[model samples]
Target: MQRIHNVTQLADLDDDAMARCYAYPRQLDRPWVRANFVSSIDGAFTVDGVSAGLGTDADHRVFVLLRELAEVIVVGAGTARAEDYGGAHPDPARRRAHFQRGIGGSADGAPPPIAVVTASARLDPAARLFTDAEVAPLIITTAHADPDRVAALQEAGAQVEVAGAAAIMPAAVLRVLAERGWQRVLCEGGPHLFGQLAEADLVDELCLSTVPKLVGGAGGRISLSASGFDTPMSRKQLVLAEDGTVLARWARR
Candidate 1:
């Protein structure tokens, strides 16, 4: 990968450099919500019904790197189901990278747990999220969710927590994760969840990868909020790949 704009002019960026560029702040006392997402050049977040088709090799690399940097990943239930979500896996190299950056690693060297936000608590108990996870997922749902479904998820070994009454609120989700000492929070969002977080001004940073393709279909943008609001962002970093993919990082201003 190469950094083409607003940088120190590195023609080629190696793995270590890339990790260094994307590392979370070493000192974080509160949950810093960083959202990672991919979309087409025309602003379509997905090609067909799934987002997997919009990803490139460069995008995938950054996706994994973001996962490595985070303490917990938050996603909407619709996204988790559509993407066939799984738990983050432990990366020894990333742990060492964190240590080199003076940011302590997980004591057990375990992967970050995924926190799924759902209003109805309608996740599959037998899904790969539960059965094939390196760490147990935290199911964040509303208090009014179906009792039987909540009990079923708990029975399947998930840590289910109530974050709201009738709906899942973004601030409450952050509070829940913050209480668990998950300071570096990453949200792999479906648009609605991203919208809510942005609306609540809970989002701190955005790591967006733009694929070079153009899908002018009935697709959605990276965020879908109930009402429009403006939150200015400052470009932090920009990188380009050989395949024409552009990855950029934006910080809330």
Candidate 2:
């Protein structure tokens, strides 16, 4: 992979080098919050109700790199359900790269945990996300969430927590994650949760994969901004693959 705008050449960009490229910032005032998403050149976030249609081999590579670097993976229940999320299985190659770079997880070096956001408490108790987790996931919801459903989920072995009363609050979400030492948060989103995070001005970085296709469908943009709350972003790096897929890193400004 090679950078385009600045024209920086990378020799193969092997796993170790890639890990260094996206290593979590050393000094953070609070937990470092980042999001990853893929879209077509025309800005279609998905096709056929999923993001799989607009991806390339390189995109998949970056996806794993981002997830491997995170301390916890955050996602809206919609995206989790749509994608049928399960345990983040161990990646031996990534583990080696992380060890070489000395940017890996805790001493135990286990797979990062998953924290899910839901307002309705309707996630499946038997879903592989719960049944196959290496570490139990954190289910975040509102105080107004369905008590019976939450009880059912608890019975199924989930750490359920209430983040707000009428709705889930983004600041509270980060606070909860921080309280648990999950500083590097990766939010793989559905637009509603993305909108809320943007509204809260909590996103620290966005790793976007712009595929080289034009999928003409009803798909929408990667995220919707809050009304009157425009968060400026500065491009930090731009890498272009041989297949015309562009992977970009943008810091919130």
Candidate 3:
């Protein structure tokens, strides 16, 4: 791995940066998925208890760009709670880009929906994830969640549905989104969710921003517990941005 100091280095690169280093090809059609994350040099998911510390100006720009390209943004409930994320509407400039790219914008006019995966139905109804956007949030949960809570979220203007049991199974969630015409899903993860998706063979690409600093703590990692997989998963070469970040894509063999 190399450390990149500027985004200019990636200006001339093509999809190879996303494909060769991240393992995602531009040729993928519906049901295509990607995991976007940023990490410290030492592999910590956070510093001072926040992920914003790991992001650079270029990283944030790239993150927004990725969001603009996605049809729907999928996130684990824990990540949503931690980050206090709202809807998935790109900013004005990015929204225009999305419209040009054939994403998020109907002739009638509607923004893209944000998908939050949770097993527990205990999230706060007044959270930013529900209040921050014009469009209603989509809460994807398992059968184990509380019925009353689900109804409550629904009443609060969220589209709540039970998609799987135990954990929010990635394959099941992807199938549901695919049915709704959400062919390209972007997962902004919080580690555990990334692990679950990878274990289920649902992740097709990984967009990683490698930060320059390092946090030596043992608190959080770029991935969650590894108990679900029967064996280790492997990755394929994708693209390497000029800033030293890498994009990798992988699939089940």
Candidate 4:
């Protein structure tokens, strides 16, 4: 173990610089799960029952950049419900960076699709995830989920697939993405989902922004699992924003 010292201020990083900093590995044969989350100094990932309440402008900037870097965004149904998740809407700058990576997009430069993981397949068909999407959403659920609900989502324009028998397996989800050539995977979590991926050893990288605040409440941690395990990770990058938000990138060691 080594002490981290001599850190420098990293402020006003231009679009290109931010993209370069968060770019996925150049060559990837399989899905590389990268989770992006914002947390308070006291380990609270949410305030007033939503994560957006915990993020600052600096954190939101990195969040958008990370979304541009990913080919697919995965989220838990619970998070999707809480955040009222919608399809990705990449701005011109983000779209340009996305295509510059040699990843072809739709004629109108649609952003990557959001894939929702749910065991119950309980999602709103009228939600923005389906209505406001340029690309159709992908729904990954278990075979035992209510067939009617699964069919409802399928009818609502989601490409539904069964990835598990009774639960949504992390490996199965990655396999589905890998088969579709989605190598750069980004997961926006609601804690429980992050816990599953971490437990399964499927998480490759984590981009975390430490918001400068102390929200003392019953907010849970950034990850939750029935059991706990340790996977050593090395800090890949550290950027201190002027607004006091600290952006950190960590990779499994």
In the range 35-88, model 4's lDDT, one tens digit per residue, is 999999999998888997787988999888777777889999999988889999
Give the candidates in order of lDDT, highest first: 1, 4, 2, 3
Q: Cα lDDT for residue 22, model 2?
A: 79
Candidate 1 stretches greater than 4 Å from native: 1-5, 8-11, 103-105
Native-referenced Cα lDDT, model 3: 0.70
Which has the better TM-score: candidate 2, or candidate 3?
2
User: Model 3 over residues 1-253: C-alpha lDDT tens digits?
Assistant: 8854323345565532422223223444568777888887788888766688778755675676676566678888888887888886665554554455454323333456788889986778888877787778888898999898998888788888788877766788888788888776788987888888777767777777776676687657767766756544345434455666554434444
User: Would you list the clashing residue pairs of candidate 2?
Assistant: none
> How well does model 2 score by local distance difference test?
0.83
| Each model's lDDT | 0.86, 0.83, 0.70, 0.85
* Model 4 lDDT on a 0 to 1 scale: 0.85
The residue-by-residue lDDT of candidate 1 on 135-210, one tens digit each, is 7899999889999999999988899999889997788999999989898888999899999999999999999999
Q: For each candidate in turn, give its C-alpha RMSD to the true structure in angstroms.
A: 2.6, 2.6, 4.8, 2.6
Best by lDDT: 1
Given candidate 3, what's the lDDT at residue 74? 85
Off by over 4 Å in 4: 1-8, 101-108
Q: What is the lDDT of residue 218 in candidate 2?
A: 86
Give TM per candidate: 0.94, 0.92, 0.79, 0.93
In angstroms, the error of model 4 at 50 is 0.7
